[model samples]
Target: MQFTTRPTLSGTFGMVSSTHWLASQSAMAVLEDGGNAYDAAVAGAFVLHVVEPHLNGPAGEVPILLAPADGEVRVLCGQGVAPAGATVAHYKGLGLDLVPGTGPLAAAVPGAFDAWLLLLRDHGTKSLADVLKYAIGYAEHGHAPVERVGETVETVRELFETEWTSSAEIYLPDGHPPRPGELLRNPALAATWQRLLAETAGAGDREAEIDAAREVWRSGFIAEALVRQAGRPTLDTSGERHTGTLTAADLAGWSAHYEAPATYDWNGWTLCKAGPWSQGPVLLQQLALLPPELPAQGSADYVHLLVEGCKLAMADREAWYGDADGADRVPLDDLLSPEYNAQRRRLVGDKASFELRPGAPGGRTPRLSAHALVAAVEGEGLDALG
Candidate 1:
């Protein structure tokens, strides 16, 4: 591959890369201090939550892939489930054919925190205090504000100022967005992490302490706070404000778990990804559909093929993929099978297809949700899968 940047460095100890530099530094520090890769990842993820709040937050979901030195690859599921009250009837009652992309109604059960904690507890060696210290420090002492963060805050300044006052209290300091490179502190977030740490003070062991912190996050003050705040309506993308349906019961009932990843074998390599519940498998499907040999990377033909493949895969995603919870679900096995891919490959042509083509699996008709179909029809559903 041509190097658009510097060549890779040879390392024996460890390496860390993240969207933000501080997160890399934080992970490297953990590794340098004798913590394992899992510990480093946990520390890095928390720092991302602090410094890249505009991109991701503590309340967001994260699906993790862990491949240890001696163990097989595993997927840590952090994708939160829909709240019990988040039923089709409830949303339909509100005249919403689709969940608004932004606002309180879009909020699911918060899963990232428990996901990280679970990774640390099961696969990591560092204590919760150690893993969290970097994030807490950054949140309390302030980190250099990223330009995108400033821009995002500015874009939402009016919304924050008027509708989401709670958000304004955090993002808008003194009624204005923080300038880029300015030191910005989130004392409230820092206190939240600190309080979780404090709750584990009396635990007998590191494992027990981690468990205690998890409990606090689920059933304690965190759950109570989320449930209370969700009672109030918030501004959403539909221009209709709505209260969140996420309850304390939802938070308490959910827990992160590990599962086998969906795998695709090509040549001698075995690639893995999260199940259809996430967007991960779409890439795998695209790869499966492509010819073994192709045009040079970034060439017009290559780009065309990749883009078309992704469009096809995403069509399948929209039609069938969802939380794996029912007896009668999308037949993922048949969809990923070689026979199905060969059939799908035949559909690719010189021209782009605006029509949605979802393959039939075991004669079962693909069920596309009304919202998904709308997104597909509007031509807003295609994602760059490569």
Candidate 2:
């Protein structure tokens, strides 16, 4: 459950794994040279693409939560949007559901690279070279493979295998993945990194850097591979996504919004997290239902409540949650408040609470900020009788 990273390189840092470690190192190097946290963060993320390919790549999305030293937290949404005319109806019309690799469909505008460079110019004390030094070194000389990374490579080898004849020269040779400790390296990636590392902006237009990074991404053989899956000949986009409008145009025309996340107070703790645009508020809503003193950490009652709460949360999320930007105004705040949670918890039977829920209650509102601890009034905890 402890999914976090802390690097010796600088200020209170965290990453998911070792590639994230390299990214952190690159950023920390910037921070050590007097750069701010944002500078370090950007440097780290940009490098993760090459180091963590199956997950992150230039075509991949980037979303972040940042709290500056003296400012309120802000979100930068780098998740790419489908093209100007992309409709879910169209997807259904085509019946194309198979997802390709770190590819065109998953592509959003390559904003992180540009955003990172911009962050550096505004907050970093070091030069761009200083920020990218570690990334360049790793791309060329290679670094230690992170745990499960090689396993992931092996798992997905068949999906990306091409019949282009020279394609084996590009990826796996003889249809097998590179083994662990075999030095995962990419010279194409190195050349791309060198371009960004060496470029000098005329007026510090960081968007240009994002453009360059995305351009670098377009050169890769995988970038344009959607053609292989195209079922229709004239529609331009086959079943696979082509390197289409997820471009510098999209990046240049884009603007990210900063929104406040939701929080809940439960069991004498204030739980802070994202909104119902994801499953974040769902967890909060479930917790808000139980009495303030539901066991301490992991008693029997605690385990039962946690499992039951998770089930309730999942049901609600499925029924209500969707994109905050595009869908009906979701009742995320009201959903997470104590009133609705309390009402929903009623669905759980006092004796067992292990069975059926027809549906959630309606028109509830948060009423109590502080409540008396109502843990166990009569019997021993965790008994079916109680």
Q: What are the Cα lDDT values of the candidates?
A: 0.86, 0.54
lDDT of 1: 0.86
- Encode model 2's per-residue lDDT on 266-306: one tens digit a residue: 65776755555556666677777676677766777788777
Model 2 bad stretches (over 4 Å): 1-20, 96-127, 163-175, 197-200, 205-252, 266-271, 349-386
Model 1, TM vs. native:
0.94
Tell me how far the alpha carbon of residue 117 in candidate 1 is from the true structure, in angstroms, after superposition: 0.4
Candidate 2 deviation (Cα RMSD): 9.2
lDDT of 1 by residue, 124-238 (tens): 9999999999999999999988888889999878888988787687789887787776789999999999999888887968889999998998998988888988888887898
CA lDDT, candidate 1, residue 320: 68
Which regions of candidate 1 fall more than 4 Å away from where they truly are?
1-3, 375-386
